[model samples]
Target: MEAVLPIEVEIPSMRVLAETELEEAEWAKQRCEQLNLIDEKRLTALCHGQCYQQRMARAFNARVRHREFKPGDLVLRKVLHITPDSRGKFAYKYDGPFVVKEVFSGGAIILSDMDGTENALPVNVDALKKYYP
Candidate 1:
């Protein structure tokens, strides 16, 4: 005796269910591919962003010159604090028509009072801004 579907109706319904399952599998695969494509796009955009950032940094560095102060050159020293209190934050951040007394090979500059008589502390070149007179 062979196993047979006494009701032909059940066989067609099972075939339909199988077809739907196959469709679902195809949908899942396509969705995965789409997700992968999206990830690839994001990766490309990230790489481009990094490249743009590097170019911006290079341009900024190129335009900005490294400070070189010679003796007798007047420069303004950046004041980290104007007062003992936090009120200094709102006040002038830079002070001085100070004169550069000496320049060190280590990027430190010895500043003198405007009268060129008194020597101040050695400060890094970064802290000194050129004074325009």
Candidate 2:
């Protein structure tokens, strides 16, 4: 970084090297030119990376569907593989017919059984689907 410095400034190094007055000025000038070139390259690289990321994000979200359900709506809760209902190969992925007892902020849903008792843990809306049957 010191090599790209615009002014004739003393550069401290672990392996100390002495610099003459004219040599120091020339080195400083070289450093100044290098600095601008490096900055332009850095800016171009950053902008290009950001644009690429945004393009990928747009493509990914293009087919994204939001999980929207109202309070009191019947919905299906997803059954995670960690706690599958059965050990068989044909275990159901979704285990609901649960009623949406309440809708909380930040997409969390309070769920209840057919008998109307709320479940222990509130479920995220994305983990649920509208009950078809």
Candidate 3:
């Protein structure tokens, strides 16, 4: 005698279960692919951000031009706070009316006081509002 299914009913049910398993495997594979795609997108965005920052930095540096002062040039010096307590006080205020003794490449201007005391002061070109004749 040969083994046989019970009225051929079990065969159909087993086939259905196999089909379900195959579908689950396909779903898992698709999920993995989606995750990889997301990672790739994030990497691309990071690279673009870095490139943008570099471009902006280059443009900012280019827009600024370096200037220096020459000896015997009259320049005004802004008196900054000498000490922490001197802020917002009438004493130790900004003093200028000095003469330029030397200049550096990065807009640094050396000024000499009326008493012939010289000090190197870094000043922006834009900060100098007037030039004396």
Candidate models: Cα lDDT each:
0.77, 0.76, 0.63
lDDT of 3 by residue, 1-133 (tens): 4344663233223344355565656655755676687789899999999999999999999998754566776766555447666645666443567777776776666667867997655565555533565
Q: Candidate 3 versus the native: TM-score?
A: 0.50
lDDT of 1: 0.77
> What tens-digit string does per-residue lDDT give for candidate 2 at 15-126?
2225333466665675667677778889999999999999999999998998788878899888866554476767787887998888888898889998888898989887
Highest TM-score: give the candidate number. Answer: 2
lDDT of 1 by residue, 2-50 (tens): 3445442232233443554657666556556766877898999999999
Clash tally for model 1 = 0
TM-score of candidate 2 versus the correct structure, residues matched by position: 0.72
Query: In terms of TM-score, which candidate is stronger, 1 or 2?
Result: 2
Comparing candidate 1 with candidate 2, which one achieves the higher lDDT? 1
Residue 61 CA error for candidate 1 (Å)?
Answer: 2.2
C-alpha displacement of 7 in model 1, angstroms? 44
